[model samples]
Target: MYTDQLKRKLIIKKPIQRIVSLVPSQTELLIDLGLEEKVVGITKFCIHPYYLKQNKKIVGGTKNIKINVIKKLNPDIILCNKEENTEEIVAECEKIAPVHVSDIYTLDDCLELIHQYGNLFNCRTEADKITQKINFKLNDFKTFIHNMPKKKVAYFIWRNPWMVAGNNNFINHLLTLNNFDNIYNSKSRYPEIELKKIRLEGDPDFVLLSSEPYPFKEEHAFEIGRFTHHAKTIFVDGEMFSWYGSRLLKAFDYFKKLHNRII
Candidate 1:
């Protein structure tokens, strides 16, 4: 018996021989766990390994999983995230195999997920090593940001009815870790509001346009900058801020550069 991040018990009678990763970050994580051979199915968005598109069975996109494709693969365990995956999809996948749902909002949770994967896949040693590396880089980032001024930021994830990386989410947690205070801290998860409204309430010190979920480009940053005259607007890599897996090995370094650019 194994308990996932969601505290749901997973019954594993045998070694995990086939893994179907529904989340992009966890797909990279499974590979980092040295379970590459066991990764039989991945979503179309699981493009980290690049070769995955050519090698593995594409079960479908994160939001629109192909049931027939998934059934064909017959995964032993399906890795999912609470935010990235929907309840209906999870319920459907549950009928086939045990689904490990991860609800992540902090660095500790990420480290625990690595350990959980270790336990699930019988790779405790590799998990420990990856944990250490993530921690080491985390510490380095802390040191790098030491004595830096805390800056209020408006992190945009979408446009139209503009949405922000709000409080109590992984993006906000990572922002705080890097000393970027979310201006939308009072709001709930991914609140949709006008950039002009946010600027009127309190002009952020920085306005970040994320390169995901909406794929904000350099032009979007300039557009947001118009409303936030007091802020420095720039395009940020969404993966570094949102990815809760092995890609974190590179996040701290990216943060260092980001902070330097901000300063």
Candidate 2:
């Protein structure tokens, strides 16, 4: 039996077999760890591995999960993320089954989460291989971009509200690792900034628009280009920069490609 801070008692008489994933990244991680048969329920956003879309049952979004549907599925375990999911959803799911909440903001957090998941799923060997692969790839990217000039960059996640990734975020960490300076390093986490202020002082060398939380297109680039004439604007994969689970295995190759385009 396992008890969390909320005093949610988890009676794990046996290893978790029927698992439901509220978070997309963790769903992908389960697949990567060869637990595809165990993952019975997953969010619609868990689109990676392609086969999951055709095979797994859809539970709902991280924020708006169908509790009734989840109850019906009778999952032995549920996987979630702290930032991507809401506290209410986690609490609700805890009442039904053992819910493992992953709180990741840095590379270390990601590695720890991977190891934790490995322990929970009895896939320690696979987890080690995945971790080694991610480390090797990230190091390769770091080496490839080590000599490049560190240009200041602003990574946008939303529009209308206009949010930018700041220090302590996974994206910001990746940017720093890739030798890019995040202009909003003073600010902690993601912050909403007015376009007027961005024009006046937030003059970053590069503007990267993400494809999740808000889908930024070529038109947005042209729109932002009007204000920051000197900055190079490009669309970035939000999953590569934000997804902290098994998706990271493929992110290094993506980052390398992006770096090549920039240099």
Candidate 2, superposed: residue stretches over 4 Å from native: 1-11
Model 1, 164: alpha-carbon shift in Å?
Answer: 0.6
- TM-score, cand. 1: 0.97
lDDT over C-alpha atoms for residue 140 of model 1:
80
lDDT of 2 by residue, 172-224 (tens): 88888878888888888998887666656558889999999898888888888
Q: Which pairs clash (backbone N, Cα, C closer than 3 Å) in model 2?
A: none
What are the RMSD figures for all models against the true structure?
1.1, 2.2
Q: Model 1, 211: alpha-carbon shift in Å? A: 0.8
Clashes of each: 0, 0
lDDT of 2: 0.84
- The estimated TM-scores of all candidates read 0.97, 0.93
